[model samples]
Structure formats: structure tokens, C-alpha cells
Target: MTRSTPTKPQANPGAKPRVIHPWPLRLTHWLNAVAVVMMIGSGWQIYDASPIFGFTFPPLITIGGWLGAAIAWHLAMMWLLVVNGLIYFLWSATTGHFRKIFPLSPRAFWHDLTAALTFNLKHEPGVYNAVQKLLYFGVLCAGVVIVLSGLAIWKPVQLWFLTDALGGFVIARYVHFFAMAAIAGFLFIHLLLVAMVPKVLPPMITGGRIEP
Candidate 1:
């Protein structure tokens, strides 16, 4: 004779409540996103003039003209990114959200690192691991470098002091390019991680609950 099997309890037949992202965080995130995209697109048009690779494409004529439009858009977006980033940073600090993201202890660091690595290997853990904290810190530092270097290059005459501080206009331009590349690299890795763990996207996007 066949025996009856036990059944598990089921969730209520209703849609989960829709949560919203914090206004400031959401605004800053989307603004930064738009700025980054514009910078990269316009930047490519500018870069084509120099042709880093063997291939060369026609110049961009969208915003104004080729390099002129690129420079204008890049500079404008630069200020937007700076203002948004500053607001986010100050808000996090004053609101104590900084502590949640920043690693406070060695034990916590190691634990987070292990958890993150394990999760990447398909052994999911609770929340963001240590590697995430380090990456976040790196992004913040890169943002600072980008802004300072950009100022030196954008206004070498007006910001002569910054140019000198950063070892001259040429050096500042190089630093700015490298910093932008670093930020782009971070974005690529971030997107890859999000694709790998789709559940992770909802919290930042919709302020929805993150499963434990």
C-alpha cells in the first residue's frame, strides 16, 4: 500500500508588497548612471579622433561637433556626477548608512570576503560580502580621482594650482582617463555579478526585500 506524504505550508495567494527605493539613493543612482553613459558615449567619439586602435571611425556631430561636443558633455556630466556623489556620500555618513556598507572589524571583513567568494562559486551566503565593501570603496576613490584630474585638464589656466598639484595638465589628463577606465571596469564587473544573482538587483532598483 502507498503511504501519504507530508505537505509543506504555502505562502498566501497574494502579490508581495511593492517597496520603493529611498528617494535620495534612487535619484543619485539613476543620475550617475545617465552621466556615466553619456561620458562613455561622447568619450568614444573623442577617442576616435586619436584612434587608440588601428581602426578609426568618423567623428561625432551630435551635441555640437566631434571633440567639441564630447568635451562639453563630458564636462557637464562631470559636475553632475560630483554633486550627486557628494550628496550621497554626505547623506550616508550623516544617516549612519555608511556603517552598514563600510567594514568596521577584521573579523567582519574576513567573514564577508569568504561569504562573497563562496556565493560567486554558487554557495550563496546572506548579504554583501567583504569584496563588495572593498569595491565600493574603490569606486569612491576613483570618483575623487576623476573629479580632481578632470578639473586640472578642463581648466588648466583657471585651475593652475590643481594642474600643478596633479603634476601638470598632461599628467592630469592621463590620470583622468585611467580613473574613468577603472570606473568602467567596476561597472562591467558589477553588471556581471547582477546578472549572476538577479535577486541582488531588486533591493537597489526597487528597494525590495533581499532574501536571507
Candidate 2:
């Protein structure tokens, strides 16, 4: 008689659970959010001191009372953003998270983009899509530009080379401002996307179901 082959156990159809963000990433994420908020508020106040493009943001939403206070707040939040950003990047790199956020090839990215645009994008529970990876990588680069430009303008004489490379003090200042704007825009888009996929937020908050 012929022996029958054993089949693997099947998962429950009702089971739709997972573990996404880990403790370290979640911690850094929240910290980074607070830091960014602080930076934006103070930055607006500081900008009021020298109204860029002949316009100034209203005081109602601005953080600091004056230029001096804004400078202090901005500097304080800068350190927090920089330190936590560094830690998050380092941890993600070491833990293989970087690979998950970066597409393996241009062809793969093109395929993903076409799928997304056509509303045929496949959603993997905890995997980053090509568009998501591109956005994430772009944001990372924006962060680096902001930090470098901020430093260049903060001490033009001390960071002379950076200032010169960026086409002097005024250019560096403008770059910093635009970089902040890019990040702010990203925040709104990110939130909108998160709202569309409600399940993703819960995983980010509670670290998802570990054994589901």
C-alpha cells in the first residue's frame, strides 16, 4: 500500500494579528514627534524676528515669546532630535530594519510605483512598499540637510566650509526653512495614509500581537 503524505497545519481564517514596531523604535518615534513639534513652533517664532519673504507666522501658534526665547527652545530641541535620530538610525541599521525600508532594485521600485498608482498595490502586513521606502528614505535625507544647514547658519564663521559650500549664510538659512517645510508636509501626508489603514496605527502603538 502507498503511504499518504502529511500536510502542514493551516492557520485560522479569523486570525489576522501581528507584531510590527518594537519598543525601541516606538520610543524613538514618539520622542522624535515631540522634538519636531517643538522645533517647528520655535522656528516659527524665530522666523517672526526676521519675517521671511515679507510674511510672518501668527503668534497664536508660535512657541517662544521672542527671538531670544525661540533660539533657546530651538537649540534645546535640536539636541533632542539629533541624539534620538542618531540612536534610531543606528538601531534600525543593526537590526536589519533598514533593508525592509529600502527597495532592492530600481525595477522593483518601478513596479511598486505603477501598482500603487493603479490602486493595485499589494499590502504586506508589516512590510514597506516601494513608495513607502522612497518616502522614508527621502525624509531621512531631508533630516540630514536640515541639520547640516541649521549648523552652518548657526555658526557661519565656525562652520565656514559648510556655509561656503551651501552658497553662504542666506542660502543655508533658506535651505533650513524649506527642509522644515518638507518635513511638515510629510507629517500631514503620513497621517492621512495612516488614517486610511487603521490597523497599522495600533501595531505601532502596542507593538502588535507577538504570538498571533
Candidate 3:
């Protein structure tokens, strides 16, 4: 006689699936962060060499000890930024990430803005709130402008058309600077929000798990 054995049933069938940031998205994100930091630091040094504005970034914050070294570092990080950015764009497009940030409604944005200003906006993992969506979209646009303006500045002679399109080298520098400012501003707010909602930080670093 053979004894029949019963298999154990699966646990918590009703439990929500754990949501995580895809590895590709996370990888590209961190890479972009590193590249941005390097570029900003090195760019500051380069800017110090030829200040467009009266004020210059402090030597402590700038990367590279001298103008030449700063230029080298800036160019090197530019490549990383471009490559990583391209990967992110492709991944996001193919994976439909753009969808999360698009078709933004003025109504929704105003509502969210009011809620945020009043400190009543709820934080939800794995979802982009209206304010977040607007910020992401704006930053993405700024990134494109910065990259193109950078290239125009980098090889103004070879990329003369681009430089001209951006209203020449001097204008390109201003455009690039403003674009950097925008990104930096976004970074400041992003960090501030992260500080306010510390839990969001883990998901960025560790691809946090969340219940639906």
C-alpha cells in the first residue's frame, strides 16, 4: 500500500505583488547621477577659467586643479553622460516610461501643486504624481538642451551649424549654463523632497519593494 502525500498550498494568494524599479532603470539612473556630478564639478572648474558671470564656483566645490584638467574631466564625463543618457532614453521609450510623465493635465498639475504647497500631497511608491511628472518632464527637456549646447560648445568649428542654431558660441555657453542651472535646481528640489520623504531614497538605491 502506498501512502498519499498532500502538497502545501501557496501562501497569501491575495497579497499584492512587490513592485520594484527595473534594474536597467536603476542602473541608468545612478550612472546618470555620477556623470552629472562629475560634469558639474568639472564644468565649474572650466567656467572658473573663463567666467561668464561675475561669480565663480568656489575652488572647493570645483573638480580638477586647473583649467586643462577640468576640460579633460568635463569631456570625459560628457561621453559617459551622453552614452548613459542615450541608454536611458531608449530603455524608457521601449519600456514605455515616457508614458508615466506625459499627457500632463494642467488641472491635475494645479491640484497637485496646491496639495504639495499645503503639505498634503500623498507619496506613493511606483507611481508618478502630477508634480513629479512635471518635474521629470522638465528635467528631461533641460538635459537635451544641455547636451546639445555642450556639443556645440565642444566643437564649435566642426559643429558650426549647431552653434549657429544656438545663436553662436557665446550664446551656446549661456544656454548651456542656464540648462545646467535648471538641472541643478531640479536636483535641489529632488533632494529636498527625498529628505522630506526618506523612504523614497531606498527605492532609488535598492529598487525598493512595495505593495500595490
RMSD of each: 6.4, 3.4, 6.4
**What lDDT score belongs to each candidate, Candidate 1 first?**
0.73, 0.87, 0.91
Model 3 residue-pair collision total = 0
Model 1 agreement with the true structure over 25-130: per-residue lDDT tens digits? 7778889888877776676676666654576445452232578777888888877888888899998788676675666567767776676667643423324555
- Name model 1 segments beyond 4 Å from true: 1-21, 50-65, 104-127, 210-212
lDDT tens digits, residues 1-212, model 2? Answer: 99999999888878876567889988998999999989999999998898657888999989989999999999999999999999999999899989888655788889988987687877766788877887788888889999999999899999999999999999888999999999998888788778766677887788876445
Candidate 2 residue-wise lDDT at 109: 85
Candidate 3 lDDT, 14-48, residue by residue in tens: 89767568789899989989989899999999999
**Which number leads on lDDT?**
3
Off by over 4 Å in 3: 1-16
- The collision pairs in model 1 are 112-130
